[model samples]
Every structure is written in structure tokens, then in C-alpha cells.
Target: MKKTILSILIGLLVVCFAGIVSADGIETGIYYEVDVSFDDDVEPGDSFDVEVEVTNIYNQNGTYVDIEDINVEVVIKDIDDSGSDDLDDDDDIDDLEYNVDDSIDFEFEIPLAVDDQSYDIYVTVEGDDENNGTRYTETFNFTVNVEKKRHKLMMKEPVVNYETLKCSRTTEVSVTLWNIGTSDEDVEMTVYNTELDISEKSSFDLDAGDDEDDIKTRRSFVLDLADAAAKTYTFYVKAEYDDGDERETEPFTLKVEDCPTEEPEEEEVTIVEEPTTPVITTPAVVEEETFMDQYGAALLLGLAYLVVIIVGVVLVIRLKKR
Candidate 1:
């Protein structure tokens, strides 16, 4: 009779503890059920060292609980690995994938191949056992902070005559802008008088392929060689754009040399001589006498006398005859 009573009491105790264990998964020190925690801080390119501890509280009946499919995933936001500052304003980091080792004490350190930003850590557990049938698995989450550096442009090709690559006469040159940053970013470029400054001024976008085109167009400014000033004055193109949410690009240079000038040529002259002295010659002539002076007075007197004499003779003859 005593043995039967003892057996019943043991069964009752088992049932009570089972309820408590189910209510609050397994527990060990600060680790409650299935929870994953990282070790301090993590940076880009650095590995993630995390620890996970699980609790399994139950009587050793023929049926037992077994933890399966334990996935530990470390995730952050989206990144193209170039120049990017797109982050969740509210810290929205989701676990897109996971890693598992099927062990109670699990550790994960994945080589981070992404941009610099904070990430949220996630622990997922799939638990299945014999005695208590199947139990509810646990999931824990946390976040970590990270940061990436921006890109820098270095001008290796000097502002010398790109074709000849030297300063001889007035000439144009082609320059190259190098992407010295490990990461990628877009570069906007502008030009100013020798000294560089950022303004709306007419600059264009430059990609990795042709960084040269960044400062292709420049504003007009007089560069006087002054009598015999140095052949050329060097100007600069200041490239500015989003580099990891910031702006940069330093000392983009351009050289301006004076063209060779020639002195004015002398004017020529020609002359012709004029003739001297006037040449005059003699002209021949004929003379004549006046007609009236020759016979006018005598001829008129004789003509009057003759006419009177003839009239008188006629008158005498006619009287006699009658």
C-alpha cells in the first residue's frame, strides 16, 4: 500500500514540473531558452563571433526532446558595396538567410561581404523530442553596429600636354581620374580659375570608365601671359559628389600655356621719274589784198558818164528824124 502511494506522488510531481518547464523554456544563468548573443562589436570584413545556449528540462522518459534545424543568421540592410548611405531610419534589419550546426553550443563567424552599417542578429531553433511529443521552439533577436569608409580620387596623370605629355606650345590634354577607394561612388566635377571651388557651374558626372569627362567643360576666364609671363597658367577642376553620404575630390589640375607671338613685318616702297622741258615748233602762213581798194571809185564815175552821153545822142537823132 505504501509503495503504491509513493508512485502516485512521484507522478503528480512530474506533471507539475512539466507544466513549469513548458511555460518558460529551458534556462541556464542569463540564457533563458534558445537565445543567440554576439561578442561586443563587429566591423565590415570582420567575422561575427556569436554564442547560443539552449535549455532542455524534462524527465528521462523513453521519449525525449531533440533540438533540430538550429539556424543562426546575421543580416543587415541592402547595399551595392559602392557609394551607398541608404539605411533604415527606424533600424529595420531583417534576416534573409541563416546558418546551423545542430548543436546546443553553436558559434557563427561569417566573413561580412557588405557595406558598413548596423545589422540585426537572429537565432531560430527547431525542437522535436520523444516523451513530451513536440515542444515549442524559441527565437531570439538583437542588433550590431558597423561602418564603411568613402572613396577618394587621386590624379596620377599630371596637367601636362597629354598628347606630347609636356609643355612646348599651346595644346589641349586628356587627364585620367583614378578610383583609389576600395568601395565605389559617383563623382561630379567642376572647373575654376587655378583654385578649385564647388558651384552650379557646368560640371558633368564621371564614372570609373571615363573619369576624364567629369570636368570636360570649363567657364571662360582670361589667362594673360603679360608681356612675357610664364608660358602657361594652370587651372583646376574641383570634383564633388556623394562619397559615402559625404563629398570630396581634390586638386584636379589643367595647364594653360601662352602661344608663340611673331613681330609685325616691314612695308616696301617704289618710285618713277617725270620728263623735263617743253618742245615748241614754227607754223607756215599765206597773205591776201582787199578787192574794194583795187577799182571801186573810178569804175562808178565812167559808168555814169557813158549812160548820159548815150541818152543825149538818142534825143537829138529823134528830133531831126521827126
Candidate 2:
């Protein structure tokens, strides 16, 4: 009877200890998961580096758990723009390893294609954790956003010899072309003005992105103003790049003015003497009277008439006597 009682006490004690062990053997929780990032803006056909780090929280209860056989991978999937559909797998990274509480940093290069967009980067880490001397598997997932690449072309302001030109002189107008896309481009630049009889075409190759020290080809169009009028003239500039990418600047204007005249030279001054005044003379005035001269001529005429009457009487008597 005493042996049976001792066996029962031993069984009860074993059951109590088993319950305690089960309570103390829970899985260790993850402390933190993060990715090292340098650039948030990514362009197409670009290769860049990405990093990842994971840490485990310290267990406070009974048994300590350590992880092994850690395999880390990076997967880029093309998720829809609305982010509702299942992601289509596009790329995968190779396997890696890590331990519990170990700071795992993974650095690798990822090359993006020209058509890759609306995607997500998923970093998955799998490892075996020790739970009360028993190993269990665990997985962790992390995500990041990859933006779409931009393909663009731009035009710079044109250079000209004169904003206000002269109609009798030649003017040189030059235009510089730049490539702002993600790859090299074949560019064709043209400057034309039919009114001025100016048409010049030139072609060149440009590199991707902006550089302060980059060499650029400047195309020049010579405008002969021999027959041009004095007015505002508009010149058109066109730039054509890769895959039918074309851009044109606003109408550049040049004002033609009349040519300036030369100034006359100054001459020496000399002093001269003034001329003398000339003398003047006046004529005398006359009076009108003739009554005396008329009376004298009348008396003589009366005397001659008396003599002729006497001669006439004598001649008459002589004739009677005959």
C-alpha cells in the first residue's frame, strides 16, 4: 500500500513539471527588421545597391532560442498600380545566412530593365529557431516601393549674335542640344527661317543626364540679311532624338533695325571784316504855267487878218475899174 502511494505522488509531480516546461518554451519574438537605403528615386536601365538587416528580441522566460541555416533572398514583383492583384514575380536574389540577434547586412546590386515599373521589392528571410531544445522554422517578410522611370528630352535657349539685328549685316544664330533621358540618344538639330532665307541642319550624339563638364556640339545658322527688311523676324528651332522623341523651343525673335550713320568731322573757324554802306541821292520837282504865251500868239494872229482884209478890198476895186 505505501509503494502505491509513492507511485501516485511521483506521477502528480511529473505532470506539474511538464505543464511548467510547456509554458516556458514559447517562440522568441523578432526585435526589428529594416533595409538600408540610399536612393528612393530609381531610373530604368540603372544598377544600384540594396541592403537588409534583421534582429531578434531577447527571450525573458525559461529556454533561450537561437536561429541557424538562415536563407535570405530578395524578390521583385510587378504589382498592379492599384496594388490589389497578386504580384507577378519578376526577379530573385541568391541565398544568404544569419543567426539569432545577429545584425545581418546584405549588399547587392539590382539591375532594372527599361520596361520595369509598378513593382515591389520583397526581402524574405527563413531560419530554424531552437525551442526547448527543439528546432522550429520561421519566416519574415519586408517590402519597399520602386517608382517608375522617366524618359524626357529638353531644349536650351538659343544663342544669337544680336537680339536687335542690322539689315545690312550677317547674323550668326547657334543652338545647343542636350539629352536628359536615361540613355544615349541620336539628336538632329535644325534652325530655319524662310523669310530670312536661313536654313541650317546639323546632327550629333548626346550622353544621358546632366554634367557640368560635358562637351556639347553647338549648331550655327548664318542668316544673310542682304534682302531682309527692317522688322521682327522669327526663327524656328527643332530637336529630334531617339525613338521619335522631339521637342521644339518657343519662337526665337530677332529685331532688324536700320544701320547707323557716321558722324561728320569738325572744321577750323576763321574771322572776316564787314563791308561799308553805300551813299544815296534824290531828284528835283517841276511846276506847270502857260497863259502868257497863249495871249501873245493870239494878238499876232489878229494883226495878220486885218492886213489880208485891206489887200482883199484893193484887189476888189481894181477889178471893178477894169
- How many clashes in each structure? 7, 0
Query: What 10-residue stretch in candidate 1 is worst by lDDT?
Result: 89-98
Candidate 2 whole-model C-alpha lDDT, 0 to 1: 0.53
lDDT of 1 by residue, 33-137 (tens): 444455445544345455554454323454334433333332333322332322221121221111212223333332223434445544444344433435434
Candidate 1 local accuracy as lDDT?
0.41
- Regions more than 4 Å wrong, model 1: 1-32, 35-40, 57-115, 150-322
**Clashing residue pairs in candidate 2 (N, C-alpha, C atoms within 3 angstroms):** none
TM-score of 1: 0.27
| Model 1 RMSD in angstroms | 23.9
Residues 1-322, candidate 2: write the lDDT tens digits.
9999999987665432221111111222242233334344554333444454544442437434565555555444443222333332222222222333333344333322222333445544455554433332233233343444244445668888877866456778878654445566677777888876787777777665334223245678876766677888888888776655655564688888888788998896888879978777676666565776658788888889999999999999999999
lDDT scores in order: 0.41, 0.53
